[model samples]
Target: MHKYYLTHLQELESEAIYIIREVVAQFDRPAILFSGGKDSIVVTHLAKKAFWPAKIPMPLIHIDTGHNFPETMEFRDKLVENLGVQLIVGSVQESIDKGRAVEESGINASRNELQIVTLLDSIESHKIDAAIGGARRDEEKARAKERFFSHRDEFGQWDPKNQRPELWNIFNGRKRMGEHFRVFPISNWTEMDIWNYILQENIAIPSLYFAHQRDAVYRDNTWLPASEFLQLREGETIENKLMRFRTLGDITITGGIESDADTLEKIVAEVSATRSTERGNRSDDKRSDTSMEDRKKQGYF
Candidate 1:
């Protein structure tokens, strides 16, 4: 399909493949941060295509929040086993047990933020010079300003203002010791683009994305599941909602919307017609408008 005639999604796939090849040609030790999320799954798909006859050269790095859905873990295990790729798990629970981070003290408490410590530790422990992620620009305002080869200091802190100019696809990954680079291949893709690409390539995603009925409680303009962390307040009420998750994170933070878009075509149509951003359902960003930027500066991926 790589010919004179270029389709939009084909172009995006070609670009992503090019970036993956670039990373393989450039870095000595690189790893893909896989969260079993849709974006990361797409990234993993591209990695497989990047080296078709040969195995994927990079390892899959998972930052486990310890509050992840069981389905995601099962998918992670299967994908790693099938792909024959090395899986490096970074556990937030270990960080908490080591007193590096403390568990929150409320009903709605979560271990999402504590993942940063584990992620950084994994990087250093594995001696990974570069970490590739599936972050897209259109996902968030702060993420929109990210560079393709974003640099992190010894402490894994991201400096927004100080970044190398990515002119004409010239990526500067040069760095001193104790520093590493983050490579986001699909930086230009939108949510719609992602769906269209998936539809075009016929890539398989986890089953949780489709429609399902779950016992949920309404709170703070989001339908949170009846997980152990979620508590029914004095006035809050529980309901049976036909819901599906738009974004996956800590069980306490991720939100679901009433949906019946079970098929891929229906999902694409629904997402295209939607008005809100994907992170709208995520309670972590609700802390403040600048919360994401603040967290990124503090080395929270």
Candidate 2:
């Protein structure tokens, strides 16, 4: 008899694929929430693999914050073009213009929280019964409490106390007419596992994750890219530095860390030796201890 074992990366891949397939089986209309981040890129890759030979059955939903890295938008457009999948964009700017959401004021202002309204609007408009996201448990405390299949109420609110149990790897996606589910296929993957899988699979990600020269300003202990949307404080000055993003979000809130790990192998090695959580530099989470949880409850993906 011969015994064989799947590598940890392979195991994670298998689980993610199984969860994705389950989403297809359980939901009427499902879409992947792609933000051009490495995690979402990985989820899109797995979705490709999950239904290989046949085109991805569902479309991709992007809640465009309008405050994004140019590199991320370029990569997102190219990836969507290559995949031959439908792309539905929910514009936050449009939401603000219509008075659906109000933009924040002051130096630390970000469109992060405003995304909740736009996302919920998009879901209702698109009639998306299940929205598959790339959020993982290891990234934040709020995400840590998420189930593989998280249910939402008629108004798209998440109730952590009323979650369904998934013992024995079985998921129950049963919901009422007005309710929906947020499915996280890569819920079990960590930052390290993501980088390792990207390296192993030679996946293509945005250049923002690689070390490059950018004009940035030091704010709240993180290097924030000095974009046109950023309002400079009285004493703050932008300086060019070799920086890279561990995670990608809105341009204002997604901070970069100074590093020389441009290649995938180097990123893997760097992540392995790091002591901080990947979301440590994300200013959105730093607002309060329950920031992410509060946002999640209001249907922010």
Candidate 3:
């Protein structure tokens, strides 16, 4: 008799693929939330592989905070064009213009929190019953409590204390009308697992992830990119530095670290040895310990 078992990476890949397929089979209308970040890129790649020979079964949805890095926007457009997939952008600016959400004020203010309204608006407008995201449990404490098939009420509010159980890889996506679900196919994969998968798959990511020289300012113990949207403080000074983003989001809050990891090999090695969480550099999360949890409860991704 011959005995065979899947490796760790293989098992993770298989699980993710299975989850992706299940989303398609279960939802009336489904979409992948593509942020043009490494994690989302990996999820999109897995989606492509899961339905090989046929184009990905769902459209890609992007909630534009309007503060995204230029490189990230460019990568998003190019990837969508190349893949020939439909892209739906829910703009925060539009939401603000329509008086649906108010922008945060002050020096450290970011559009991150306001994204919740726009995201929910997009989902309701698009009639998307399931929104697949790249969020990983290991990335943050709030995310750690997420279910593979998370239920959201008619108002798109999440009840963390009232989540369904997923024992033996079984997921219950059943929900009534006016309600929806948030699916995370890569929920089990960690930051290291993501980098390793990206390296193994030769995936293309945003240039922001690689070390490069850019004008940045030290703020909140992290180097924030100096851009037109950034409001510098009284004592803050801008200078050129070699830095790379561990996580990407609104440029106003996303911070980069001094790094020389220009290639995937170098990045993988650095990630393996790093002790800090990926979102540690994000100023938005620093606002409160339950920041993500609070936002998530109100339908933020």
Candidate 3 C-alpha lDDT tens digits along 1-301: 2558887888999999999999999998999998888989999999999999898989999999998899999999999998888999999999999999998887667899888899999999999999999999988899999999999999999999989888987889999998999999999998999999999989999999999999999887799999999877787789999999999988888899999999999999998998788898988888789988999999987
Query: Which lDDT values do the candidates have, in the order given?
Result: 0.88, 0.92, 0.92
For 1-301, candidate 1 gives per-residue lDDT tens digits of 5667978887888888988888888888999999888899999999999999899999999998888888889999999999999999998999999988888887657777788888889999999989999999998889999998899999899999987778877788888998988889999899999888888888888777888998898887788888766778998888998988887777878888899999889999999999898889988888888989998887776
Instruction: Single out the weakest 10-residue window by summed lDDT for candidate 2.
Output: 1-10
Off by over 4 Å in 1: 1-3
After superposition, candidate 3 runs with Cα above 4 Å error: 1-3
Cα distance off (Å), candidate 1, residue 148? 0.7
RMSD of each: 1.7, 0.9, 1.0
- TM-score per prediction, in order, is 0.96, 0.98, 0.98
- Which residue pairs does candidate 2 place in steric collision? none
Model 2, 108: alpha-carbon shift in Å? 1.6
